[model samples]
Target: MIRLVKVSKSYGDTIAVRQLSLVVNQGEVCVLIGPSGCGKTTTLRMVNRLIEPTAGRIFINGKEISRVKPEQLRRSIGYAIQSVGLFPHMTVADNIAVVPELLHWAKSRVAHRIDELLRLVGLDPLEYASKYPNQLSGGEAQRIGVARALAANPPILLMDEPFGAVDPLTREKLQAQFLRIQQELKKTVLLVTHDLDEAIRLADRIAIMASGRLVQHATPEEILSRPTNKFVHDFVGTDRALKRLSRIGVASFIRPTHSVKLSTPMKEVASVCERCHWVWVVDDDGKFTGWLDRTSLPAANSVRQAMVVGDRDEITITKNATLREALSRMLGQGFNSIPVVDEEGRLIGEVSLGDVEAATAKMEP
Candidate 1:
């Protein structure tokens, strides 16, 4: 758990943060977001003593952070930034092992921790361990930065634009991976970003900042539908409903009952009927291939030939995709529904336009 009480930071005459108070609960992800120069990142740096508060107090698990040594405080709190900050001379394994090694972990323990962290961030230790930072791509280095931060298993994490350096597609993948890792590890997280979409997608609570002040703090649903002031409302934008969709995942609205395998006899595939008017098709490996029309398929034709098939990226939404993404696919392709697949393209479920509309209807005021 992390808490900041009346926190303020000033450099000469300029105020970086003013009376900014916020709390990040245990195992929760609290995102700080706003326009440029809004003090969101300043507030995060104050948490792990990267920036000393000019006046207020910061606490980590009930102990005041100022009372602890800076180095010690940092070691107990994982920090990742936009630039990645990996030491160019150090190999990937050595970089991840830094915190654990500093903690005096046994050589064997540190080695194991390094490998575990590399895999957690979606890299294979065998392939990446001996490589230097310069050998990695921007996205790969960002992942390594995250891996190093988690190397010590710190209960608290501070991320300042952690995904900001990567391309949009890679940024999305990193966000998805971070969400998955958070679900399993449950570390209390404070992430700073100027991106409203990222905040809505990854936060349990969003803290919106402006002019070095905390403008609003609430769940993404509340923030989207019930902005506290004019600044908050306009900052959230005119498309608040679309922003709300970022908080709803495809998994929540998935309809998994109407799928048939490529090997399924046409007679069996033709027998099923759903109001959506089509059934999803998958290979023997369960990888989603396409969809078949329920009304026209003949008992003699194989399921694959009669069904619509296109580029996987163009047609399918991943199980972790937001309802907004599902709706976009449906509207762009002019479909009543879209299939949801796993990372491997396996059919997991389908989400209809109705499902996304219902989710929007439930947004709070």
Candidate 2:
């Protein structure tokens, strides 16, 4: 956990950061985002003591970070930057092992950590371990920078536009990978980025800064659904509603439905059909197969035989997928119902058009 209390920074005549106070809970990703010249970067730097605050106090896990020696405090926290400042001459493994080596970890332990971190960030230790930073792609270099920050397994991570140097596709991949890693590791993260979409996609709580002051601090949904002021609303832009959808999931819209397994006979399928337009056909493993037309089932012997064997291209979303993803799939395929599945591909439930519409309606101003 990290906290900043009425913190401010000034460079002689200019104020780089205003009286900013904020908290980043343990295992939460708090993103700082705003236009250039805003204090987001300054606020982040103050936390690591890279830029000492001229006023107020900062604490980490209840201990004032300023009380600790700057080097010691920094060693306890992981830090990454946009340029990926990897040593050009050092091997990937060596680059990642810098912090652990500084802490005087055993050679064997450092080696093991390097291997683990490389794999954790989707890089092959055996292949990349011996390569220099120049030999890697921008995305790979960014991942290495992240792996280096994480080498010591610190509980707190500070990232400043860590993926900004990569191409859009690579940036997306790294963002997704970082998010997945955060989900598993759950480190307290303070990330600074100028990209609003990035902030919405990755932040557990986003702090929007402006003119050296925090304008808003709220969850992505709350920020989008309920902007604190005109500045906040304008900053989120006209696509705020669409961005809100990107954060919601199909699971939030799914409701209990009369579903039948593949083994269910045609008669049983017909019986449970009720007024529903179609029956969902699922395999023995409970994975969705296709849909069965109720009208056509009367002439068939079994549900499987009656089921439309067409490409199950019908929108299928995982439990972790967002409502916007489901909506995108539906609009792309022109389908009204989308089958929801678990990680193992087992059918869970179906989300309908009415469900999505209702959810969107509830989010309206």
Candidate 3:
């Protein structure tokens, strides 16, 4: 755990941070966010003593950082920054090996750790180990930077815009990888980013600041649903309530699917439709194939003639999808309800627009 007591930083007459106190508990990711020159980067630097605070004490795991040597203190904590900051001359494996080698681990242990971290960040060690930073793409280099940060397996990690440099699609993939890695490693992380969506997706708690002061600090759901002040309210934007949907899982709102196998007779399909206005058609394996409505039942004599053979991808979403995504899909397809499927495309349940509306009503700020 990390704690700050009345921490402040000044540059002669200029103040970068003012009497801010915050805590990031064990196995939590606390994101610091604000506008440019809002002292977000300064606060992150102060944590690792990259920039010393003018007043107040900072402690990590109950040890005050001011009492420790900066070199030793830094080696014990991991840091990753925007622009990647990789040594242009270094290979991927050598970059990841820097810290472990500093800690004087055995040669074989360092070699094994290099491979372990590469795979952890979703890169292949055998292919990437000897590759130079200059030869990699923006996304690949970012992964290497993350691998290097986790190289020492430090209990605490300080990341300053770690995923900000990549394109949007690559950034999302990197964020997912970060979540996967965090789930396994459970490191205490202090991350800085100006992007609210990224913060909402990744942070366990968010710390909002303005003009070098702490504006609000709370869980993402609370901050969005109940902003502490006007500064926080506007900072989170008018879409705050909508963003709350991302926090909800599709499984919570799932309803039993009304479906029939393709081999079923059209009369039987029409019979199944009596329980519901819409009936879904699936293969013998139970994979989603198409759907037909009760209104269309009288137009055909056989199941093949009545069934609307359409792309399943256009009509189905995985059970792992969030309510926000489900809502978006429902609107796009002109659907009041849609089928939920497992990884293998077998229909499991359905989610309706009503479910999304009910869940969203409770998120008003």
Regions more than 4 Å wrong, model 2: 252-318, 329-355
lDDT of 3 by residue, 1-365 (tens): 99999999999888999999999999999999998888999999998999999998899999999999988988878999998999999899889999999899999999999989988888888899999999899999988988888888899999999998889768867987898799999999999998898888889999999988999999999899889999999999988767888778799899997888878888788778989888878888999988887888798786667788857767888876678768877898888888899989999989999999998787654
User: RMSD, each candidate, Å?
Assistant: 2.8, 4.7, 3.5
Residue 117 Cα positional deviation in candidate 2, in Å, after optimal superposition: 1.1
Per-residue lDDT of candidate 2, residues 142-237 (tens digit): 999999999999999999999998786578668878989999999999999988878988999999999899999999989998999999999999
Which candidate order results from sorting by TM-score in descending order? 1, 3, 2
Model 1 agreement with the true structure over 158-270: per-residue lDDT tens digits: 99899998888789889999999999999999999988899999999999999899999999889888999999999999999888887777887888658888899876776
Positional deviation of 218 in candidate 2, in angstroms?
Answer: 1.8
Q: lDDT rank, highest first? A: 3, 1, 2
| TM match of model 2 to true structure | 0.78
In candidate 1, what residue range of length 10 has the lowest lDDT sum?
A: 267-276
Better of 1 and 2 by TM-score: 1
Model 2 scores a C-alpha lDDT of 0.86
Model 2 shows how many backbone clashes? Answer: 2
